[model samples]
Target: MAISQEISYRLERLILDGGLAPEQKIPSERQLAARLRVSRSVIREALHELQGRGVIETRHGKGSFVSTMVPGSGDLREQGPLMHLFEGHPRTLYDLLEVREQLEGQAACLAAQRATSLDRHRITKAFRALEETDPLSNARPDHGFHQAIVEASHNPILVHVLNSLKNMMLMTVQASVANLNPRAEMRKKIVLQHRQLYDAIISGRPASAQKLAMAHVRFVSKSMRDLELEGSTLIRVPVEQEAAVSHQNAQD
Candidate 1:
């Protein structure tokens, strides 16, 4: 197979196998060329092929990305939802993150106020599953944990809205995760944020829960932006002092 074809195949597998999420931007051609040890022309050719196959797409200047509407992704559309419009755009996944921040923050606050013992149990279980999941596992139980939180809100409309947005959110998560090397020190920060959010919700602290949830989303959004600027799949993780402080507070 030609090198470009090979690159296309490898990237296709990343998409189909859940390594790359829909609507999530791929690394730039220069980055891909360097990573794959190929020329920029080869990377462009491979990206073009992926775009033709509907496995990925390229925005005018934003670079190429996996398609949010790929056949195997289930119920996703190229442009059916409001959120998908931002897909492959230049915002670096922030558009989707903004929607999520609004929706999920409310969900978390409501869950704090409204969750029954049983709902809390389910949410806790889901959080456990998410915690145990390998961070590199793309976006599986992460969505599950958040979905559980939404359900715990006891608001049918919020649950419905969250459910509706999940497809696009999944794509966003895939893209954000693509650049995260889970073994890095930033793992503590991720763990700290999620754990704090879970604790706040389960403890019936609506204000705390809402704040924590939004903070988590914003962190992910910023990370996506940083990854895009660097033009590489390997994202650099900075040690967050706040995360350490939060961890100690949690312990107390």
Candidate 2:
């Protein structure tokens, strides 16, 4: 990693570990530079990274302070039990689903062209297991299936993008499943749709796999929106609106 990245990583860790609290001021530029034994420029670069992540805020002539309730500011470094992901905004989730569909569709196409026998075996096993389990228990394994496809593509950049997308997909699925209308039978249909995607992947048909993956993602996205509309009183979506807001999940 570059020097700036190394510094940013450490500073982010400090924020995640609760060394810094919301609205609390951080060390001044010179103080930080002295403490870290780095030049002021390096400190500035690191501070900029923290700001981008929504962990800190800068005020004109007042130095930098920790931002409380910032987007993606929660402690994500520590792996724990399932974090509560309340229902996301209908439009925002819809948009994210679209982005994911575009990325994963490309990933599926690449995987079809490049996947080795071992990659095929792993994806097949994951799909088979997903088919046998309940939706709630199968969410992570379902993630594994998608992740395997990205890895099989042999493109590091695509792998990174898909890796980052996995968390939101998992959280969205969990929320959608939990908020589903039992009478509508959305969950069962969703599982079946996923099965179709898996089948297409196994067949080594890139175009078919891509199409199926897109339909499956859009299906879940629409389901979540439908649930929000029908049962708006029960779901807990965020009121704050920001274009391209981070979900604060660490899985990415």
Tell me the number of clashing residue pairs for each predicted model. Answer: 0, 1
lDDT of 2 by residue, 112-158 (tens): 87889998999888777767766545545666777788888889998
Worst 10 residues of 2 by lDDT: 243-252
Q: What is the alpha-carbon lDDT of model 2 when measured against the actual structure? A: 0.69
Model 1, 1-252: lDDT tens per residue? 899999889889888998988788899889988988989999899889888677887898888878877856464333444544544455634665688888789989999999999999999898888778776663556667887888888899888876656544443333454355363766677778889999999889999999998888788777667766778763222222223221110000
How much is the lDDT of residue 52 in candidate 1? 69
Prediction RMSDs, each to the true structure: 17.5, 10.0
**Predicted model with the maximum lDDT:** 1
Query: Model 1: how far is 163 from its true place, Å?
Result: 2.6
lDDT of candidate 1 at residue 140, scale 0 to 100: 57
TM-score of each: 0.56, 0.56
| Candidate 1 weakest lDDT stretch, 10 residues | 243-252
Compute the lDDT of residue 110 as modeled in candidate 2: 80
In candidate 1, which residue pairs get closer than 3 Å at backbone N, Cα or C atoms, i.e. clash? none
